[model samples]
Target chain A: MSTFIQQLANGVSLGSIYALIALGYTMVFGVLKLINFAHSDVMMVGAYVAFFVATGLNAGPDPSIASALITFLAAMAGAAALGIAIERLVYRPLRSASRLSLLIAAMGMSLLLEYGGQVVFGPQHRRVPDVITDERIVLGDLNLTVHKLIILGVSVVLMLGLHFFVNKTRTGTAMRAVSQNVDAAKLMGVNTDFIIGLTFAIGSALAGAAGLLVAFHQQGDIDPLMGVYPGLKAFVAAVLGGIGSIYGAMLGGLLIGVAETFVAAYLPSSFRDTITFSILILVLLVRPAGLLGKFKPEKV
Target chain B: MRGAAIKLGFLVVLVGAAIGIDFALREIFNPHWLRLIELAGIHVVIAVGLNLINGYCGQFSIGHAGFWAIGAYASGVLLTVAEQKWGTPSAVVEILLLVGGMAIAAILAGAAGLLVGIPSLRLRGDYLAIATLGFGEIIRNVIVNVDAIGGPRGYHGIPVYTNAAWCIIVAALAIWFSRNLVTSSFGRALVAVREDEVAAEAVGINTTRVKVIAFVVSAMMTGAAGALYAHLDGSLDPDTFKFTKSIEFIIMITVGGLGSITGAVFGAIVLTLLPELLREIHPTLSEYRMVIYSALLIVIVLVRPKGLLGNRELSPSAGIAWLRRKFGKGTA
Candidate 1:
């Protein structure tokens, strides 16, 4: 019973990272209607940036909150820059092109980042410096670590901030408008391009934070290709929650993370991924538009 | 009757040419070059199969590697079982075994395709792509857990039945089959569906049935290619069928030009050889080969969104026609 609660805690911590990444995928898919396969690679880039910053600052053997904050900011900024660059360069030119073209372009961008990362980062797995202290909190049978607490706290705060921003801010309103109808938004005097770029920036910034959190979770075992699996599962989370629904992305991520954790605990560890995917298929089967997504019939 | 005779004669010439080249290459070129050629042929089969679904049917699938892996393991297991049952059979038995293995691979892989396709084909475009991707990963994970087929250690000791003759002949047959398929009425229906699904449905075309057929056939072709790949490599690893490998095939068709059979073949050949060419230029340069290819992909998408060939054939006749048109000498 204690183990169950412990597993639940572990799952939520993992799920938080997935939620952050899924937010990026859902948002990009919302506005641009493009998958942005490079989103994962962007997360990878953020992690690498954080790695460099943490290492360069010599955050030292001891964990410091200031250093971690600095590292997070640096990575998020770098990732935001990259996200905007990808949209401006790769996606912008093909705005009027077919969805297939956009998808392929996005894939190309993904491969470019992955392989280019290999070339730039030299394919070596770099150990991330400890920016957070290794402290654990025990509550009766349940044990929680400082790292896990930080992950949950940061994720919740960020999500709430995003919620407020999207609901209250002008830019966020423009983003919502563009996603609802790009041409209509343009007619209403919104800079559709700027909104889309900003969407990428915000999404990518979230992915960047997810990257650092994930690095922290794994004790800084970072690599160029580290983003592939997490990225894939996150994309699945985005889809599972309903691609265009931000709240759905969060819920789906947490659901998948918890389900995966339970499966790993109860079933053969190899079945963890298989079970997670099966759940996705089943959910998709029942709810085609996803749990939170509203289905709009195609206009003939 | 005259046309039939000419077509028959052409097939004979093509097969003969393939066999002759296989033998001649064995004598002329080293085994390394021969392997590369064989690998390119395998990619050609895969790319064409993928094109049938993605290009013609307009359904996106990045899980083709799953079907390919299924075919490979099917054939590998079949041959392994045969060897255990009958020790070192004669030449006739060897030929039979190879044919039987490929047939089994096709059937099993096709069934697997049907299983995945039926459920997922209901989804549109990007959703379908994601579902298939998930299915592919599930397949890989399943393969790893099953211990009878070597699991994560990889299935080894598979006999090498694939030669240059087999590669060329199978690739030619696959391309021929796909060409015929795309040119037929069903092919027209597929193209129509790709152009507009709602209109196709409105026109009384069963979009679902057409899509399922395309998906199954494509899966079968990919499976056959996987069988060939297994024999050629003499080993099967689940890792080889990862999602990234599926992306590689997508790159091929997209680079060559989707919906163009000749483009698939051309793209497969160029991509397979590009790394080798880079290595020849500089051993270290091969490390940057994927970076170059990906950059090229982006450039192609930005400059010429329709790809290099853009659904056009690049056959000898077409080439000659193009040349004549360019020179303003023939037909005009």
Candidate 2:
């Protein structure tokens, strides 16, 4: 029972990270109908930015709460700026092309970010400074790390914040309007570009937060290739939940995380990735629109 | 009469120049030029095969490397295990085994494609992209876990059978096959399906069949390239056929031009050569080569979204004729 609970906790923690990054992917897809393949690298950029900031300030493994907060904000801001720049420079120009063209371009941008990051940061892993170092709390045989609790708590809060922002804000409504029908949204005088850019910024900020949380949880080891697997897993979560549905991405992330953890525990570790991807393929085959996705027939 | 003479003269001069360059490279370089030619040939095969599905049929498949891996392993296993276990096979027997290996790989990869394609064909653009991407990942993972094929350590000790001559022959065969395919009735149906699936279906064209056929054929061709790659490298590693390699193949097709066979060859050659030239400049730049390559791809797509050739075939005859008119019989 304790093993099950521990697995559950690990799944949720990993799922939360996947959910946060998946939100960015689903949001970009929802609004622009383009899969930003570089979004994973964007998350990597966020983690690295936070790493640099924490190290620059001499913020050791255990930093003051205020310093941690300041470092996170600075890192998120840098990530947001990078996201905005990529959108404006690389993707914005190809807005009118076929989806295939955009997909290829996004892939190229992904490679650019990954290799560029490698070149700049060097192709080595950098340890992230641990901000939270409290030990685990044992409750009868279920020992839960304080860092896990913090990650879960912060992730839930951020998710709720995103929900409120997308559902309640004027810009959020405009974003919904554009996603529903860009031509109709444009006809109604909504600035499509502004909404798209805002969506990218918000999505990337969430990725940044997730990145920081992951760094803190993992004790701050960062690598140029760190984002690739997580990014792919997040994408899987996004698709499994429903590609353009925000809530669906969250649910998908948790489910996948749980599924992966259980499989790893029960099955051979070698088969973990294979099992996860197999689940993705099976889910896609069964429901092309995904668990929460709606299907719209292709327009001639 | 003058035009005809000029065209003939230009052809002679062009052939002379090509031979001259080939001989010069043989003398100056340490067999590196041959290797480059082989690389270009392999890429041409991969790119052209991808063009059939992604370019002509308008299906977005980023999993070409998965099929490539399948082919490489199939060929590698045959060359290493089968020959030793059975007998000292003759040259003819070995050749037949290699071809059989390629066929089996194509069949296996094609089956995998069908598994992914049948249900997901109903999904549009980005969704299909995700499905294919997932399939690619699944293939990689499966290869990693399966111990029979040496798992992640990869298969080695395969006899090195891929040479410049073999690469050129395979490339020539691929190009010829694709050219014939795109001009046939079946090819027109593929084009129709690409243009508008609904309309094509209404007109009695089996869109699903066309899609499946194109996808399977494309997978097979990519598998052939993988077979060649395995032989050339004398070993096969799963990491070499990752998602990144798939993306590189996609870049070749996109930067070359979609729906153009000639564009595939041109793009593959130029992109392959550009990196090789860069590598010659500085070894460190080789690590940063993908960054530079991708940046150039982005810039090119932004500036000319339709690609360099954009559905146009290279007209060697026309080029020769123009050159002859300018150079006045090539001073002959």
Candidate 3:
């Protein structure tokens, strides 16, 4: 029972991280209807930025709240800038082109970032600072870590802030409008390009924060290829939650995280991924719209 | 009479070139360069076959590697098992076994393609892409787990029977098949579905059937390529057929010209050789090779969007037309 609770807590932490990344995928897919394959790379870029800022600023071995905030904001900004740049330079011109072109372009961007990042950053893992001090807390049967708690707290805050902004802000409303109907939104005088850029920026910023948090979780180690697996799984989460649904992305992320945790703990670790994918395939065969997604029939 | 004579002359020249080239590859060219050329031909088979599904059929199937993996392992295991039972067969017997091996590989890969295609019939675009990707990953996972074929230790000791001649023949056959396929009515149906699925369906074209056929054909071709690849290396590792390899094929068809066989051929040859060229230019520069290719990919998609050949074919007629305008009294 204690082990179960411990595993459950671990699952929640991993799920929260997945949710942060999935939110980025869901939002970008929501607006552009294009999967930003490079979104996870933005996470790596973010982690790197934070690493540089922390080390460069002479934060020393001990990182306080102020230094952590500095690293966090710097990473977010760097990632946001990257996401916006990719959109403007690579993807914007192909907006009117076929989805295939866009997808290929996105793929190219992903490759460029991965390989270019290797060239630029060198094929080496950089040491990152832990934003929070490590502490293990045992409450009853559950084993909780300070890093996990911080991650959960930060993720919750971000998700809530996102909800508030999207539900209330004018720009966020425009984003929703464009996602719902791009042409219609354009005719209604929504700055579609600006909205799209903003979406990428915001989504990428969240991913960057997730990156730092992840690095912290992993004991201050980050690399260029670190984002690929989590990024792909997050993408799977986004799809499982319904591509265009924010809440669904979060739900899907948590569900996958929990399920993966349980599978790894109770079953052979190798079967974990196979079973996860099989379940996804099976569930998708039944509910193509995903669990929380409604079937929106197109006017063909 | 003149056309028949010209066709005969062309056939003779083609046969002569094949015979001469095989000898030249064996006796003159370095084995290292020959290996590169052989690998390039195998890639051509893969790229062209993938174009049949991705370019012409208008489906985004990225699981070509999965099919390739199946065919390779199938033939590799078959030959390994057979060799144990009956030592190394005679040259003639070996050739026959090779043909039989390719056939079984094709059949099994085509069957797997059919299974993956059913899901593709319903899933559109990226969903199909992911599903096929899942299928590929599943295959790799299964291969790694199965110890019968040496598992992750890598399958080895298969005879290296795949020569430049075999690769060239198969590559030529693949090109021939795709060329004829594109000009046929069935080919037009694929283009129709690509352009507009609803319109194609309304025109009484069975989109599902067309897609399935394309998938099966592509899968079979990929399988043959895999068999050829395995025989070339005389070994197999599940890692070789990863999603990264699938992406490489995608890059090929996209670069050459989607839906264009000639473009795929050109793309395959250019991509295969470009890295080598870069390596020769400078070792340090080679590290930037993928970066350049990826950047070019981005640039092409952004600037041209239609790719090198687009829907256009590179035919002798095009050259003839250009020459006619240049000097045959129709110029400006």
Candidate 4:
């Protein structure tokens, strides 16, 4: 029972990170109908930014709550700027082209960020200093790390904030209107570009937070290739939950995290990736629209 | 009659000049140049095969490298292990063994393609891309875990039989097959599906059949390229056939006009050479190769969305017209 509880905690913490990143993917897909492959790399950029800020300021080698908050804020800002710039420069020009063209461009953007990060940061891994050093809490053989609790707590706060923002704010209403019908939203005089840009910024900031949270949970190590696996997993979560549904992205992320953890723990590590992908393929084959996704016919 | 004679004469001259240049270059340049040419030729085969599925059929498959790895390993295991088991090792027998190995690999990769294509074809666009990407990852993981094929450590000790003559022969065969396939009735159906699947289906075209056929053919050719790659390298590693490698193949297809054979060849040659040239200029540029390549890809798409050739193939008559324009009609 204790082992199960520990696994459940691990799953939720991991799932929280996946859910955060997957929300960005699902939101972009909902609004633009384009799979932004570069979003994953943006998350990578966020982690690197936070790593540099924490290390350069000597905040990490000596753990301090104030420094962590400042670094996290700086990372979020940097990621938001990068996201806005990418949308304006690379993707905005090809907005009128076929989805394939946009997809190719997104991939190009992804490669650029990944390799450019390699060039600037070097290929080696940099460790993030642990700012949270609280002792593990033991409850009758169920030991939970404080870092995991922080990750789960931060993720919940972010998700709730997003929910409130999307459901309550005027811009969120505009975003929903555009996603439901771009032409009708335009007819209603909504500034599509601004909404789109804001969506990317908000989504990218969430990814940035997720990156930092993950860094904390893993003890603050960042590398150029760190984004690829998590990116692919988040994409899988998005697909499994329902590509364009925000709530679905969250659910999918959590389910995939649990599934992956359980599979890895039970099955051989070699078969772990295969099992995860097999589940995706099976899910896709059974429900083309995904688990929580509802199918809407394309506009002819 | 005059036009026909002019076309025939131009073709003859072009073929003669090409052969002359090939022979001259062979004599003047060292073996390294020949090797590069051979490598480019193999990539041409792979890229052209990818073009049929991605460019012509409008399917986004990022798993070509998985099939390539399958073909390489399949052929490598047969040629090396099977030869040892049999113990004959005669030249004719070895030739037959190699051919058999290649055929089997093609068949296996083609079958794998069918398995991936059947379910994926039901969805449109990005979903298909994700499915194919998943398939590639699955293949990589399976290869890494399977101990029989040496797993992640890779396979070695395959006899090297890839040569200039074999590379040229394979390139010619692939080009001819792809060109003929694109111009035939089946090819027209593929283009129709690519343009509008619903419209094609309304017009009685079996979109699924056409897609499956093109996918299988593409896989077979990619497998053949893999066989050649295995022989050239004399070893096969799982790392060589990763998602990035598949993206490289996609890059070749994208830069080359989708439906143009000549574009694939041009893309394969230029991209292959550009990296080598960049490496020679500055060693640090090697690390930034992917960054530069991706940036150039984005810029090219924004600037010329239709690609360099835009569905046009190079022809002897076009070459003669260019020559005549350059020489001003009285050079002879």
Candidate 5:
């Protein structure tokens, strides 16, 4: 039915955002093996930056393509800088510390961003300037919107660009090498710290893009805590797709988005969160390594 | 046998003294301060239980709020039913009902812990954290869906049976249990597992069983604390048992020193009192309280990674040994 098509379209658009956020989580997790709890906060920061930029530019409800591009670019740049700073300041110093210490530090970093955001941005919701018009496009019985198209197009383009960059670029290869074996990568004269920072930068930029799109999609829904649920759900997506796998995170995000949308449509709305989490537990129980993650037997 | 009897007698005296002080303080201090002290004790119970899981067992399970919620709702439902079945009970019967409710809460929470623990047996580090996080959200969702217990709106009018004396007694018991647990051979097994899981399994430690046991015991204690919290507040809100609350408990144990019962107790009391202390100082300061709290956490981890106590118990014998070492041979 047309409703099914509409739902699928909506799910994919949501999934694209989740995929973008999950990329950051997966990439950082790949290099550092830390959960990077603050990554979600970084996404929040990105959304806020875009909000300010668009507002500063006086972009009304229907901004031009140029203005939207500038907004996205500024947000991504700001977020990337933050990511590198977090790595250098908070994480890098604790490189040799215990796992518990690292995790707690990460948590502290997350809280600092969230509460600090409340302090800086105020706790109230800010309606994002409409980057794109919310005009509906009717294709026979299917209902589509400009927001959905923009989300899909931008996400696809970015994902393709990222895929090529990670697969083909020398810097990306060096990044992969560091993730596999830090010492080995260092031995090969790779600047491991720089690569790690670069990983954070790239991952955070993706999250920034995701944040901007989400803000645009859910006009007037931007807030300090907006990233928490999406961040968590995206994390579940990363895990479901087998964390550390780029393609897996993408796959997982889409699957979760579709499943969540379908569940919301069919079941009592309250069960939406429960179902998402249930999938995570089920995946973890069945395949602890995640969908795309390889199982490594522990060495004594 | 004499040593066991002496220890028992000492605990009994300590508890009796606490109860006496609690009553005396009520007559002297304002209700506000008294409530803070009671809440501090409750936090101690939860913190100690969390330490047993995260610190001793080396399993980072952050779904503690789920267990706490379970205990609170269970106690709330029971007390509500009891009040309906038999109007207001006599003083003695009221005490019995509260104790019975706590026991049931602990049992239910412990059972839920077992369910969560089995799934966690296969996970480690961040993965375990995520699964536990998921379980916590699931619990909150389930609570919201159940219409009988007020669901999202939360339960109200639970009997107020919790007090400073009750809180102190339970907190003392929690500390005692954790101390005994960490010092025993089983405790050694847990430490071994924390240090290295594969090595512990190689040395014949049933890692799975140890983890599950830790989860059950920790959940049980937290559940009891939840019951006390319910009775103290006379209400239950599902929102109270969110991931953020679990993070608060984790922060307490981390600040106090993981795997140290005394550290957990110390951390719990200090943290519970901190917000109140800030509020007393100034409203603006309290507004930025969480920021300060988080910064302190980072600084502590950066400075003393093992936490303040660093897996060391704070006891008289240890204090004496420390004093002797510090002051050369003459101090003893």
Candidate 6:
């Protein structure tokens, strides 16, 4: 029972990170209908930014709350800038192009960032400065680490903030309108480009936050290609929860995280990565529309 | 009848020329480039095969590497066993056994294609792309886990049976096979499916059958190419056949021109030679080669949209017209 509870806690922490990243993927796919393959790379960028900010500031593992906040905000700002730049420079011009063209361009941006990041960042493992000193917190049979609790807590706060922003804010409403019907939203005097850019910004900020959280939790284990697996798994999570649905992405992330954790605990650990792709194939075969996604009618 | 005779003469000349070049590479050229040329020929087979599904049929499957891995492992395992039983038979017997191994590779790959193609029947566009991507990853993982094939450490000790001659023959056959398929009535059905699946079905085209057959054929060609690659490399590392390699094939078809056989050939050759060409420029340049490669992909899609050759095949008159369009502003 204790093992199961601890595993569950670990699963939720991991799932929260996935959920944060998946939300960004879901939003980008919602507005543009492109996979935005570079979105995951933005998570990498976010992690790197935080690493530079945190470690460059001090060599100590633990930093005060102010330094941690500064690091987090800097990563968020950096990722948002990158997100908008990619959307405006790489994706915007190809908006009216064929789906294949858009897909390829996204892939181009993905490759550009990955290799370019490797070039600029000098592909090597860099440790993220720990913002908080972790302590063991025991509750009943559950063994919870302080960083893990912080991850879960921070993720919930950001998720709630995003939910409220999307549901209530005027700009967020414009984003929804554009997603529903771009032309209609344009005619209604909504600045479509600005909204799209804002969507990218907000989504990327969340990913940045997730990146920092994972960094702190993993004791500064960050690298250039670190985002590839999480990025892909988050994508699979987005797809599993009807892609355009925000809550669906969150739910899907949690489910995949828990499932992966349970599988690893019961089965050989090598199967951990394989389980994500297997679930992807199964979901695609069973429900391409996803759990919460409404089936779209094919236009003749 | 006279035209038929001329066409037959052209094909014979083409094969003879290919064989002549192969022998030249064997006897004359620096042996270093011989390896590159052989690898280029192998990629040509893969590019043509991929074009059958992605370009001609209009399906967006990017799992070419999965079939390539299958073919490599199949060939590697078979050749290893065969060598254990009969150590390096006569040259003629060796070629025959290699051909036999290639056939087995193709069959295994084709079966995998069939399994992947079934889900494709129910999906289209990006969904299909994701499915194929998943299939490729699954194949890689399965191979990584299975220990009899040496698992993740990769299979070694395979002899070098693939050479310039074998590569040329395989590439030539693949080029001709795809060219014929693209011009045939069945090929038109594939184009129809790509254009509009509903319309194709409405016109009595069995879109599913066309998709499945195209996928199977594409897989077989990639598998054969994989066999060549395995023998050339003399060892097979499972990680070498990852998503990146598959994307390279996609880049070839996209850069060449989807749905154009000649375009597939052009893409395969240019892309295969691109890194080699870049290496001559500088070592650092080669490191940033993918950056330039991907940037070109974006630029080409933005400029031509259709591709370098677009839907048009490379012919003398067509080439002249294209040059004129590029250079001649309005008619003189």
Which candidate should be chosen as best, given lDDT against the real structure? 1
Residue B171 Cα positional deviation in candidate 3, in Å, after optimal superposition: 0.7
> Taking the tens digit of each residue's C-alpha lDDT, what string does model 6 give over B138-228?
8898889889998999999887788887888888889888988988999899999988988998999988889999999999999988888
Off by over 4 Å in 5: B1-15, B329-332
Query: What tens digits encode model 1's per-residue C-alpha lDDT throughout B1-332?
Result: 99999989988998799989999999998999999999999999999999999998888898999999999999998897788788877877887888788888889989988887877787665766877788889999999999999999999989788889889988999998999999999999999999999999899999989999999999999999988998897899889999889998998998899899998999999999999999999998898988998899999989888779989988888888788889976557
Off by over 4 Å in 2: B1-31, B318-332
In order, the first chain's TM-score in every candidate is 0.98, 0.97, 0.96, 0.97, 0.98, 0.97
lDDT of candidate 4 over B106-165, digit per residue (tens): 998999888888887867657668888888899889889988888999988888776665
DockQ pick, better of 2 and 3: 2
lDDT of 6 by residue, A34-90 (tens): 788888889899999998888777835556878878888999999999999988887
The regions of model 4 sitting more than 4 angstroms off are B1-34, B321-332
Clashing pairs for model 3 are none
Estimate the TM-score for candidate 3: 0.95
TM-score of each: 0.97, 0.92, 0.95, 0.93, 0.97, 0.94
Interface RMSD of each: 1.3, 1.4, 1.7, 1.2, 1.2, 1.4
Report the lDDT tens digits of candidate 2 across residue range B176-216: 78998999999999889888888998999988888888988
Tens-digit lDDT track for model 3 on B134-191?
A: 7787788788878888888889999888888778877887897798898899999999
Docking quality class, candidate 2:
medium
| lDDT for B77 (candidate 4) | 82
lDDT comparing candidate 1 with the true structure: 0.90
lDDT of each: 0.90, 0.83, 0.86, 0.84, 0.89, 0.86
3 or 5: which has the higher TM-score? 5
Q: Can you give the DockQ of every candidate in the order shown?
A: 0.74, 0.72, 0.59, 0.74, 0.81, 0.64
User: What tens-digit string does per-residue lDDT give for candidate 1 at A34-139?
Assistant: 8889999999999999989998888858568899899999999999999999999889989999998999999999999999999999898988888887678999
Least well predicted 10-residue stretch by lDDT in candidate 5 chain B? B119-128
Worst lDDT window (10 residues) for model 4 chain A?
A127-136
Q: Candidate 4 i-RMS (Å)? A: 1.2
- Model 3: runs farther than 4 Å from truth? B1-20, B330-332
